[model samples]
Target chain A: MTVKINTAEQAASLIDKYDTFLFDCDGVIWVGNELLPSVKETIELLQSKNKKLIFVSNNSTKSRIEYIEKLLKLNINNIKLEQIINSAYSTAIYINEVLKLNKDKKIWVLGQNGITSELQNFGYETLTLDDIKDKELTMENINNLIDLNVGCVVVGLDFQLTYLKLCITLQYLLNKDIPFIATNIDSTFPFKNTKLPGAGSVVEIASFSSNRKPDAICGKPNPGMMDSILSHHKLNKDKTIMVGDRLNTDMKFGSVNDIDTLLVLTGIELESTVSNGHPDVTYYADKLGDLYALGSK
Target chain B: MTVKINTAEQAASLIDKYDTFLFDCDGVIWVGNELLPSVKETIELLQSKNKKLIFVSNNSTKSRIEYIEKLLKLNINNIKLEQIINSAYSTAIYINEVLKLNKDKKIWVLGQNGITSELQNFGYETLTLDDIKDKELTMENINNLIDLNVGCVVVGLDFQLTYLKLCITLQYLLNKDIPFIATNIDSTFPFKNTKLPGAGSVVEIASFSSNRKPDAICGKPNPGMMDSILSHHKLNKDKTIMVGDRLNTDMKFGSVNDIDTLLVLTGIELESTVSNGHPDVTYYADKLGDLYALGSK
Candidate 1:
């Protein structure tokens, strides 16, 4: 049964039970640049109680440091750069740490500067759309002369996606030995009030063409995104709670990893949409501000 | 049983059986621009016997007229524009004759000039990437205000594909009432010794993003591409043969529609590839030129 937070006592009991709080940024804390009302105070209250606050986002467009800068700009204080974990950061971690790829193997990225930069920071050579600018480039030209050095294809939210990039990605992925990795398999990226094609949409082209599935999807709900945080901090799953707005990514992520999930109604999901079939989301609140009841008492 | 035509007597007897020949251009007729040697002589010999010949291609990159021009340039005589039925041509026919879409309802095309031109020829209002060139275009602007007048979204081989085109395609397709159409689902467009991302790749992105499947695929192996030819001609199914190199598209198209199929080794398929599980192909030859044995007798 999902515990509904109706009063200060219930809220306080729930909040006090967890030593660490994992927050999904886009919907729970703020939607777009505007901060959800009282979210600042709610987070600060959790911080005052000495609870560990970590912001986990599937938005691979921005790096973790950039997210920290945005958070500080929004007046969200007491947040460290280490406290944020974006998909881009986790993807690099999954590749370098989990996959244990060799330093010599390069990655062909079909994403923005954020993911590319994160991979580069891990001391791996990366190639982007800029690498294949030859006007005379064709399939035959590259067919005989494939850069076999490229061992992985990393796909993320790319606005500058092109046909040539997809061709190159397919060529690499055709070799089953060379892994195909995606930051997230989100069909659409909801921004403001609308949705655009996300990383999954771009990756689907190569996947459909080559008849291959992504070897690893390093994002929320995958559990690989939580690797860095789990290693750095010691937290019990029983006491830890994940708070987010989206049911698929955030709620599923928490449920899949055995952490208690708190669903908020500030974003992608609605109260009417939740049902008995939903994966275990332990609690539901109107907004993060409702958690402020813990400090009120 | 698929008869292996290794001898001239078997080849001649098989060729004499079909009154109407439907050819898949890529593998059987020619690989790329270069026509397979003896294919020209074989086609001329078929013409001398007064057999009706039709060049059916799923390559929507060129119009029927353009295909005729290419054929004439290669010195293949006696083929007219109407004798060539391309996916683009049939897609237009399917929309006009089958769908019977209202003339006022404009179509949003995510393909090349070939399909757009064909739609325009049918007196339908067509919009393409060139139509949405306003510098201020964004997802937000198209969010609340959608072009609801769009009755269908046609996806095909587009070399100049862009992200905005995909966004618009998804926006229209989300309506559910609006139809999603594809020229072909051929994974890759085989061109000049290389395979490039084809129409299927572009459609996969929109299909994945929208969580929708194509309402109609107007290409070979789908039966819609042969609809126009079937409607116009009164040929017997037993006397009509689909000659092509690939077992999947070409042979399947014939088998699905109850027409005889001939598999050639000049393109995608080899003798080793065919098995009992595949759709029935009536005959197999080394190349299109091998059919010349029929005339030699």
Candidate 2:
């Protein structure tokens, strides 16, 4: 059964078990732009204990640098570049280190600037949706519109996604030699008061058109994404705990990686959802701010 | 074994076996507005023999009326409205006779005028992509944008497919009570010596975003499409043969429906493709024109 860290003594006692914490940013740290209650004090308490804090997010729309800027803007201080692990940065890392694609070949992107920006920052040239978004697809210009030099196709969330982008992306993906990668396949994302279709919804069009699955879906819930993180960082599995609000992605990420997980109830999950213990989650907390209760005590 | 109707005697002798002929329009009779060699004389020969010639096409873009206009424009004479069996028409028939959707509820279409025209002609109300093509998806207007009167969602080939159409289609499909249908799932269609993404590729976005398979795929090879034709027409299956260029959709349609199949060249397939007899196909011809040889003889 999953333990509930209700009291300040229990929350303080739970902190002693893990030296490093992997935080899922959206729900645990902040909801959209506004910081959640007691997030600052909780983080300060973790830092006072010298616990390592890493923000692991599935935010494919923002690069690590962009994410860091947002974190600092949120007044969450002392965040390092290496402390961020987002699907965009993870996707770039996968393409660079795992695929080891040649530097000469360009990456074709069916996404926004975050993907291209990260890929370019990683020393790889990219051709994004802007290159062909405005062009019309016709028998006359199809051959010219498709870039044969594109070695990899990366699909992420594009606010301005159109049929033209999907058509061009499908043509490239049809070439078996060209690798297709999706940053993440989150079905939907929260916007204001509701949810909208995310990258998973968009990328599946190219996958269906090509009649092929993506070479890599580099995101949470996939053990390979965690493996990529493990290879980059030198951390002991016993000392780390993944902290998040979502059970399927964040908690499952920890369980598959053989790390512990702490689920907070401030985001997508409700109090009633944790009535039964999930195989992935180790403990449930009222909120991330529960750790700050110990500091006040 | 599949017989090759090479000689006039063989072609004439084969015509006596089937009283009804289901013709695939795109490749067998015509190839993109240009009639195939001897299609007129061959069709005329069949008509003179009192053979029923039904134009079965996977054309979801143009309605039956529009298709008839194209046939007349091409000077293909003696065509009857009942003789045309396009996916657009088949889809409407399926929605009307099989699904029995209420006449009051409106159908939301993610396709061209073909789907809407057919549905509207069949005494059903519809709203196409044009209705929401200009509307932007925002948290503020999501409630007002989605029409609750939508009873079914139809997806077909939309040349003007935009992100807005996909986003709206997904919202309706998410409601399980609203039936989801696809006209066909042909991966690619020939366009001026090139094969472009077809309705299958376009409709999959809604299917994936909604995370569910369509309730019905009303097109060739499904057997359900042929069933729709059978339900409407008083033809003997034993006396019917499906003539098409493609083996998968056309021949398979005949096989599953317990009808014989005639393979014709001059479309997508070549001589090498029919070297061995396929279980579904009964005979192979150099072209649909081979049947015209008997007239010349």
Candidate 3:
């Protein structure tokens, strides 16, 4: 059962229950370059109370560092590297810390710099589209271009996706020994009242072509990724409340992980959709700004 | 029960049963540029006996004229346009005769020249990758590149596929009003002791990205394509027999359409696996050229 947050006392009581707050970046705090109304005040209020604020985004198109830069530009500064957990960063962490892949086992990335840059940060070599984007991929030369040294393949949102990248990625995926990891399968991301193809859709090409299932999908509402993030950061699960705009990815992520959830109306879902899909939402607010009722800093 | 054709008497008996032969060109008639042994004699014999032979291939990479040219190079001559039924041609015939689309409703193709050429042959204008291959595709310019005039989207094997083609194809597909057609979903086509991504694999990218299932998949083991070919050519069902190697595609195609099938052992399938997948196969042969035992011309 979800309670409506209309009164300042109700918002304060609910906000007081959690020591840490996990936020879905896109629709919760900001949309694109502009932050939602009262989001600044709400963050400031939480910061004054010394509540741990972490931004978790399913978007693998941008790295956490890039996200930080974007967030800073929006004047939401003082975000530490670990405080932001984008899907690309989650995937990189999963591969490096969890998978503990040997240094010799190179990863072939079929995504944007978000994935490649994050993987590089983990001290792993990756074959990006840039390495062979200009090289001709004929039947006679495809074998030469395919690096057998690649022991893993990472897929994410790649706006610059090409047939050559897919072909190379499929070749790597064909080897069942080489683990396949996808950032997310969100299909379409919300864009200007429309939906654009997401990381999951991009990964489907290689999956369909190779007839291989991904070994790991590092995104919500997957509990594995959430577990990895929580464990990696030593986050107190009981005290951390998931606050987001969407019920499926955000609320469901909290529900699946047994964490409390607050549904904010500033993103994909409206109050009407609240009655459907995920009924496990703990609370619903008209906007993230509603939490500004418990003002401070 | 599948009768094995080994004896000359059995071959002659089988040959006399059918007035028309539906051959899968890749394995039944020829493998690449090389025609199977005794194929020339068998075809000559069938021609002399007034057997109406129709070449059906799931390969949408080439048009009927192109197939005819390739056939001629292999010493197979006297082929008419209507005698060939490639998946691309089947798609064209289905769109023209069955769908009977409006002239103003143009089609955007995400494939090789085979599909575009065939669609053009049927007097339908198409927007191929060539039209926008040079243009820059950004968020700002994508709307201009998408021709909402496209009433249908056709997908097939495209070795020269690009991100622009997929984005444009996805945009056209997102509008549910436009019909989506794929050549086939065979995943991979058999190459020299290996498998390469097929037309089906190529189509999967756009299908995945758009999250829209195709209106029609014009290939084997789909009986729709076969029905179109038969209805167009005015072939007698009772006299026609599908002869091919692969059980899943060629044999299953015949089985689904309630047609007699002859499994040839020159392609993807072996004689052992025939008893597994499609048990409806009427007969099995060591090779297609085994029909040479029924010699005449």
Write one digit per residue (lDDT tens) for candidate 2, span B1-297: 788888877887778888889988887878777988888888888888889889888888766676678778777888899889888888898898888899999999988888898899889999975666566654356656788889999998887776667667777987899998889988777654555678988777777778888888789977657867877787799988999988889988899889988999877887777777778788889789889965486
Model 3 lDDT per residue over B89-170, tens place: 8888878877788878889988888888889988999898676666776654666777767898899888777665676787
lDDT of 1 by residue, A1-297 (tens): 776677888888887899999999888888878999788888888888999998988889977888888888999987887788788877888888878889899998989899988899899999876875554565456574357799888988888776767777777887889988888888897655667888789878878888888887878887777664565465677878999998888999899888899999898787866644355678888888888844465
Looking at model 3, residue B190 earns an lDDT score of 66
TM-scores across all candidates?
Answer: 0.86, 0.84, 0.91
Count clashes in each candidate, considering only residues at least 3 apart in sequence or on different chains. Answer: 0, 0, 0
Q: Where does model 2 exceed 4 Å of error?
A: A1-19, A30-41, A62-76, A132-140, A231-239, A265-279, A282-297, B1-17, B30-41, B62-76, B132-140, B192-194, B265-279, B282-297
Give lDDT: candidate 1, residue A25.
86
**Ranking of predictions according to lDDT:** 2, 3, 1
| Candidate 2: docking tier | acceptable
- How well does chain A score by TM in each candidate? 0.89, 0.88, 0.88
By TM-score: ranked, best first = 3, 1, 2
Clashing pairs in 2: none
What DockQ do you compute for every candidate structure? 0.55, 0.48, 0.56
Candidate 3 per-residue C-alpha lDDT over A1-297 given as tens digits, one digit per residue, 9 for 90 to 100: 778888878889877899989989888888877889888878888888889998888888765778789878888877888898888888988888788898888899998888888888889998875776656666656666788789899998888877667777877887899999988888877655555677877778778888987888889888657866876777888888999887778898999889999998888787887654456698888888888853432
| lDDT values, one for every candidate | 0.81, 0.82, 0.82
